[model samples]
Target: MTTTERTAASYFLPSDEPLGLVFPDGAAADAPALPMPADDVLLRLYRGMVSGRRFDTQATALTKQGRLAVYPSARGQEACEIGAILALRPQDWLFPTYRDSMAVVARGVDPVEVLTLLRGDWHCGYDPYGANVAPQCTPLATNTLHAVGFAHAARAKGEDTVSLALLGDGATSEGDTHEALNFAAVWKAPVVFLVQNNGYAISVPLSKQTAAPSLAYKGVGYGMPSMLVDGNDAAVVHAAVEQAVARAAAGEGPTLIEAVTYRIESHTNADDATRYRERAEVEEWLERDPIARLKRYLTDHGLLTEQVQQEIDARAEDEASALRERMNVDTVLDPAELFEHVYAEPTAALRDQASELAAELEERA
Candidate 1:
């Protein structure tokens, strides 16, 4: 047979199937058994997945209501965000982008504190020292470098900390990402660059981002290992990230993981996806929704029942309601707090400016 015929036959051959969990149309005829997790941990994962979706929905609503400055929804990418985070240890650092609030939530960051940043009260809402989570980096791709630097520092200190940096497909085109990979490969930094290929970076499709066949293979140039996985499959994402983390922790250099998933929503509250993409395309992805796939997996395995599902839904609603209530609380910031951390000792120029600002305010009052 010719090469093309052989490749086609391989896809049709049952014995030559791809090795990974497959859930089509959010359903599996014979559900595969999952590794037993502690009852609390299992429930927590379910709760987190549900709550994260609910939080994203509510935050989007708040943006429409003008209560929030702007919002980014991780509606369909919850599995990618949560699964990778659930695999991390407390000591490990997470470098999150603007859309990684779900992962940050899974990392033990308070939803209200995260909202403080969205509400524009603080540049960084959560205390990194307390939560072991860094502030969400707004500038794209720079966090990859930060993660590499952090991993290098941890390695120097002989600590077993791993750094996971999350970015979108659009960020792969940035120079900082290339620099991060080069630095990590040379220094053998324990960092994992997790790219969620949600197909678009603010309306620009992945096709426009790069001509490469796969983002994962980009690691080849830096001499790091890489893999592409079904990002919507929580099981696959969890397993892949677990393996990558192990490799990094074992002193192997960084790994680039390109998770193939769909965004299913606008890039942010300000975006109108319909303007650029057709609704039919969005609906097509809705059929492969990540949450539905996981729910079906659990249900088919008899791990989730109607009552359990109801409970999970109720819990998510309660948490989201509480978060909204907390966000409604006074979000005013102390203007002086900004200057407090700008320098160890205020420079003469800055001090003079602060004095002038204080006097101007007093005079206006």
Candidate 2:
């Protein structure tokens, strides 16, 4: 109602099965066909998925080795993580959740800096404004409103900038998510919300998260357009995200996308998935693996050649090796650094507290 209205039908997805370009078996879907991406784009998507899965394994290994404090593996959710990044423009801002470490890395942030927070660092590793990506927010749904504010500011300044908020299904139920969606629609801010519905809010399943038909349907109440897409299909994820990004840039307010994905790994290194779920369930989702599905489709189309595969694998390995090497090295710690960023100008009381802490650390040293 703010502006840029669209046909009511366009706001709702035609099918409930989740719009998909490729089937689980690598076959293209029939009826109301979704267009496949260009060959090069598909290849790039494939490469990103492959490398992302490899990175997940490497990160998991780091956790076992005690190098990383913990890692939320995006092993099965690579499509959503990588596709969302590719859909974004360089000048656009991204507000990501902690689980979106992989997505942040895809946005060209340094891999090392991406893990600095998970490594138990005090401050967020990279500069949010500098990288154009907010810190990998650990608090649930807190950053969604930040995205809305940023997008609204950009629109007020008449800048052609958009904000993309990437969160999970669990976040849909938070008060901040509700406020963010409503305010964004009312302000007609150019922002896109990509909710990766990975079936669980920790150990709780989606059935407990919301009784709504689907997470995307949450958009209706906010007067935002929404889409439900198969998150395991990289092509569809990228295509859908691109469409949403286009709408935002066109001043169409916001779009809510509930990507139907699965959390292939447990909640984190600390959680034992088998405690609540069956191993067979995990095995079943494995067959629909995003990387394998995309690889099959590209190979059949003659897009992924043997040499290309080898080169991509080699590069991924090199990156993993470098990451492993760097993470293994112990970093020098400065106890006094914790006082930074609290205030532009330090309060006397705060200065005294910091001085006391510095003195304590000096004595310990």
Candidate 3:
């Protein structure tokens, strides 16, 4: 077997020691295999991180006000979201989980469109082909298969396309995740699996999810390399993902990246985080906030001034306001619209439901 096809026989855990490119103490700790980003790129990443946080905050507030049915806030995991998507080229595709709307936005999809599925309106808010982004999958790890298939097809067509599949730590436990990895490795598909290990899969802690040394280690069994990085450090996460993309593009198969981060909020608007985790744990993660950490690095190096910081914050605020304005408008639901995308032709069961719902609406009228 070639080196790329050599499966690791022993089960091992990912290194508990996380890789960090930039530290919270305002220093670049260690660079990854990929070269560090330029200062300007770093600033852009910081701005993106700030914008993602603002979007999450506003979306969470909207859920509370009944403007949205549900929101899985990525409040503390913005770095992982930004880094994974930012590393991809325009030709690359992204498959994100429902909680990773920020990644969809960062990939240049309309912010409002990214929220479409969560708004309870459509299958996806934007055109998947138009944006090269798959729907924000609500079911755990199912999108992994989609990503692998897309990447494999691209390779067969002699196209240099890589697919980045972003999933929550909880998703790592799903059976589809294993199937996707196994297939990708065997086929040498140009895909990257990014597991944002936010310490919990909803109410269940990582310890209860699996006994594997780390989610990253699961890649080794599939004959792929695995990386561990501090997900709160944007530069580190970005570099790690960038390297993985490069490897995939070179026909080096797949890489599994486990980003060590924390979820600072409840699983969703309807979840009570207090029931499962201690407030102290959340507070500790707050100190390592992605935005704050990146801001500190920029300021310490004289790359950002107070004026620049204010400007970035102002831009984020304006974007948030626009998103709120768009979401606040009431949606006009046509009872018939529900049956439109069920299939090419509606199934017998779906046709019956559509008729029943139409009759019920007509009676109210």
Candidate 4:
């Protein structure tokens, strides 16, 4: 049999082995070849992934230490987040879920600002106007509808902008997701629904979430095209998003991309996956970590060396340390500012309440 056929057959078997662009350790040598990326872009992707991973780890630690209220760790899904965000233009809008801090970071958000939201100091960590990223949606699958509406607005205004809404696999079960899909398809909105299928939603696995074989095919019912990409492979994720963004910009209808990836960590600080899944399952996914796969890919292609990897690791660690220092010092938010942005012109009742809050704080001080 040919190499491609052999590779396909190997993955076709029912095994706990993960499916994605890059193969696991034993399967790496037999995996299909990947396209070569420009040296600079490849290095940048590597550094971004490294930085995001470090930031995720540090943020989780902060949550544990009570420096932040709560944080979601996207440890294994960094490739999918950074790869997709890096493929977008500055003018494009990003609708990210709670687990998508990495995408926000890739889109030029400061790490300290992201921590602000987790610290409960702000509704959104960064100003959407500055970063072109919307306030992260805590309600699952609801942001898909918002993205469609924003895309529709952009089209009506004759602007060339695409909206990318990132959601998780578990979110597919929500009514809003399907509603957004129907609306985007009907109106031909310039939106891409990026579903990061990380195996489980909290404790529920994909099998319990839906009957569909793959999440991407759900777009077919809405009369929109879709594709499944190896979310763990930065190259594949980037290429897939690049095509979807181009298509949306060119006035094509929306595209739904189900990026097949795994979450190596808990769903959030509030979750404990150990209750529903085995330690072996977690260990298995750790073996196919996305960051390590990309690192190997870069090293094999001569784009990264041991010294370069060390430097990247060091840089990420330093950035995380600095971010923690800044977040620690800047955690406080003015009680007045919360009421300040509540309305363009505060209603009589709101104004009275704001005054009362101010008076109370002043008395306490």
Using lDDT, give the best candidate's number. Answer: 3
Candidate number achieving the greatest TM-score relative to the actual structure: 2
lDDT of 2: 0.86
Q: Model 2, 113: alpha-carbon shift in Å?
A: 0.7
Span of 10 residues, lowest total lDDT, candidate 2 = 1-10
**How many steric overlaps does candidate 1 have?**
0
Error of model 3, residue 155, in angstroms: 1.7
The weakest ten consecutive residues by lDDT in model 1 span 10-19
Q: Report clash pairs, candidate 3.
A: 13-213
Model 1 lDDT tens row, 55-164: 89988888888888988899899878987888777788999999998888878898878877788877788898676788898899999999999999999999999999
User: What do the candidate models score in CA lDDT, each in turn?
Assistant: 0.80, 0.86, 0.88, 0.82
Off by over 4 Å in 1: 1-20, 26-44
> After aligning candidate 1 to the native by TM-score, how far in Å is the CA of 313 from where it should be?
1.0
For residue 327, model 1's alpha carbon misses the true position, in angstroms, by: 1.1
Q: List runs of model 2 lying over 4 Å from the truth.
A: 1-14, 30-34
lDDT of candidate 1 at residue 60, scale 0 to 100? 87
Model 4 pairs whose backbones collide: none
Q: Write the per-residue lDDT of candidate 4 for residues 133-238, one digit (tens) a residue.
A: 9989899998999999999999999999999999999889999999999999899999998999999988999999889778887887887777777778776677
Q: How do all models score by TM-score?
A: 0.89, 0.95, 0.94, 0.89
* Local accuracy of candidate 2 as per-residue lDDT tens digits, 1-365: 42334545554443566989888888776525446778898888988877787778988899898888988888789999998888888889999998888888878888888898888875788877776999888889989999999999988998988899999988988999999999999998999999999988889889988888889888888877788889999889888888888889998788888899999888999998888888898898898998889888888888889999999999899989999999899988877787788789989998999999988888888
